[model samples]
Target: MRQWRLAAALIAMPALALAAPCELKIGAMGPMSGSGAQWGLSMQSAAELAAAEANKAGGIKINGETCKVSVVSYDSKYTADGAAAGANVLAGQDIHIIIGPVGSIENAAVKPVAARNQQLAWNAAYANNALEPRFPLMFQVSPPPAVWADLLIKRAMKTFPMKTVVIVVPNDQTGTDVAGVDAAAYKHNGVTATTEFFQRGTTNFAPIITRVLATHPDAVDTASSAPGDAGVIVKQLRLAGFTGPIGRVGGPGTAEILRVSGGLDVLRDFYWYEAVPTDDPKVRAIDDEYRALLGKDPMGGTTFWSYLPGARLTLKAVQAAGTDDAEKVAAVLRTMPVEDPNIGKGYWTGKKQFGIAQGLFFPFGIGIIKDGKNLGVERQEAQPE
Candidate 1:
């Protein structure tokens, strides 16, 4: 009887190991297609790199055992319904932590579903209520306009003066949240600002460009439009003989913007926001590391670099917590220091704004293009929100 019991117990041990494989799955979601594809792809790329780093180091230590880290990516399409479906999909797979949905509406949709599913998500959205106290698991990917927009506007005006500006964006939550803040920043700097909106997926921006030019503003700002849409607007603006300075106070997509806007000649006298210190050698090394590990060049744009710290820190937290459970991970994440090897020192802010000190604040960057000259990017400390 004793020999038979020992054999049955030995068989059950294998079944238990099969039930929980020696692997950790990290979930990544974003708009992986369309004009906004760059932003979502950046998130996916960042997560993939973080996982690769962990796996290369023999994976993260969970419960005293090294488990391989693998990334599962999803295209949330930057929509509420899309994000909801994505959250359900990841949750169904027993994924308790996620990194993505880089738009205001998508984050709004994701938070509720993540909460219901007892999952934790980090969103790169700049919406007003991106990180609420109620959703302790929801964390901001980076600081919003209120933290860096004022300085960016000041620098831009110093480089290229503007008395009036017209900001164009999509007629969606992402547009609304960014346009309002960008306009406020412009106004605070004593520049009169007006806003215009176009439905998402409007390929031809001639009508809006005409409306923008009719105002005869000193500059037209592509506040937070997708890089693709912003590029078309810049192209049309140049074609319309609008030679004044152009501004981009939204997301990082200067590479894509330049491609769409017909390069430096057309995008002359441009001032925009960047999220990483591209000029720093340490920061630039990330590109080399990414290419070396992934065997391909990084998805272009500073968003990918900016998104890295969050993903890296999350993995570190998983190692420290020794578990993938959302609540435990959140607790470990809160106590962990905000630091990245390439990006350097940062802090966890958002206590005043979101009632939780969960937002990631790192040094930001501002880029300039003057008279077809690429002046590189300048780094600035991200103030506490």
Candidate 2:
């Protein structure tokens, strides 16, 4: 009887050892097919990179078992209908953690689906104040417009002493919301600001440029303008003889703007709200890895900094909570300090503004483009109003 039992145990040992590790699927939902395809693709790429790194390091540990991370992405086309469909698809795949639905309009559509599924969503785009109260599980990892706007205005005032500013943004809801926040920030900083909206897909910015320059403002604030629109506006503004400061308040689009502007050196002296400091060892390492994997530098936007760091923070929270449970991970995220290479050490904020501590409050990097290269010069911490 003893010999028989030993043989049976030895047979079962192989099966136990060969058991497959639990798979953790992370959903990346964004505009993977529209004009903002670069944004969505970058988000997907960053999340994949993070997952690949974790897998290399033996993946996430839970209950003494290893969980392999996988990022499953879906294209939302930057629309409400598309976002809803994408959310449903991700939910069907049993993905509990979603990276985006990039714009506010898309996120608005995704909120219900996320709430219904009880999924933890990290908003990779700008923080829409309206979404937080309704969707408790949705968290905004990017700094809110209020935070970045404050920094932009301060830097503009100190460097150029601007008094009157003209804000131009897309005619969509996201643009309207950002313009409001930027207007408030400018007002608080002792600057008068006016806003002009342009329809999405308006390639010719001459009319808008003429009208904006006619205002005789000290600076033109492109508050959260789409990458293509921003490039055209900058190019036209320079061509139209507007020499004052141009606030690229909508994160750095250095490469895109340069490409769109026909390499015209239009972004010189622009106050960009974010840029990866090339001098930082961590930033360089990430860039190197990204270039190696993607065969190109990260899109000239927040992708390099936002998604990768957000992924790192999410995994850290999962490790801390000891499970992939959304509530458990969220609880850990609320108290965790994010020390990623992109945003640096910071805590989750936004209780006063959004009635939830879901926004990542970190030092915003302000940089300038000189001779066609972005160089991070100053860092501003988010201050309470």
Top lDDT: which candidate number? 1
Badly placed stretches (over 4 Å) of model 1 are 1-21
Q: What local distance difference test score does each model get?
A: 0.88, 0.74
Q: Write the per-residue lDDT of candidate 1 for residues 1-385, one digit (tens) a residue.
A: 9999999999899888777658888888989988888898988889889999999988988788899988888898778899999999989988887988788889999998999998888898888888899999888778877677889999999889989999999999889888999999999999999999999989998998889989999988898898988999999999999999999998788888898879999999899988777788888888889999999988746789889899999998899999998899999999988888998889898887677788899887899999999998998976544
- Candidate 2 worst ten-residue window by lDDT: 275-284
How well does each candidate superpose onto the true structure, as a TM-score?
A: 0.94, 0.85
User: Candidate 2 at residue 175, lDDT?
Assistant: 82
Model 2: per-residue lDDT, tens digit, 1-385?
A: 9999999999999999998869889888787764466567767877777777788778887766789899898988877798888888988988878878677778888888888987888765564564476677788756667666776678667667888999998888778888888888889999999999998768898988989988999989887776667878988998889888788776555556667766636676577666344345655577677676546666425555655677778887887787877778888877776567655666667777777778766555676655444555566655443
- RMSD in angstroms, all models? 2.4, 3.6
Report the error of model 1 at residue 25, Å.
0.6
Write out the backbone clash pairs for model 2. Answer: none
